[model samples]
Target: SKKYHCTYCSKGFSRPSSLRIHTYSHTGERPFECPEEGCNRKFSVQSNMRRHLRVHRGGRPAR
Candidate 1:
């Protein structure tokens, strides 16, 4: 399998797309936002947004 490495954190990914998205964490760029009507929360990763949606679903946010 091919590998992609992060220059800032030394993390490795199997896909270049994953590495590109991970770069947003280093840059502090949040392009994903909660879609709930009253929530203004934003996330640098999609998984975080999915986890955050638990709050809207009446469940605790992931710790």
Candidate 2:
């Protein structure tokens, strides 16, 4: 078992992959990209890109 610690709590995982994904809260890396034409946008996580895509699809800006 692999043990991991966070600012508020700690936990253990059977596989390192789970721990690795959980560690993203500490490292701000943009790994996901927007595929829209002429829009070279990258996001720190996949969900951010998903949210951004809606804007290009005629969604109003979050003012």
- Where in model 1 is the C-alpha error above 4 Å? 1-3, 7-12, 60-63
| lDDT on C-alpha atoms for all candidate structures | 0.88, 0.67
Q: Candidate 2's residue-wise lDDT over 1-63, tens digit each?
A: 456544334656666666555556567556777888989998766767888988788775422
Q: Name the regions of candidate 2 deviating beyond 4 angstroms.
A: 5-28, 60-63
- TM-scores for every predicted model: 0.68, 0.52
Q: Which ten-residue region of model 1 has the weakest summed lDDT?
A: 54-63
CA lDDT of 31 in candidate 1?
Answer: 90
How far off is residue 10 in model 1, in Å? 5.8
Clashes of each: 0, 0
Q: Candidate 1: lDDT of 16?
A: 94
| lDDT per residue as tens, model 1, 2-62 | 4889999889999998998989989999998999898999999888898999988878764
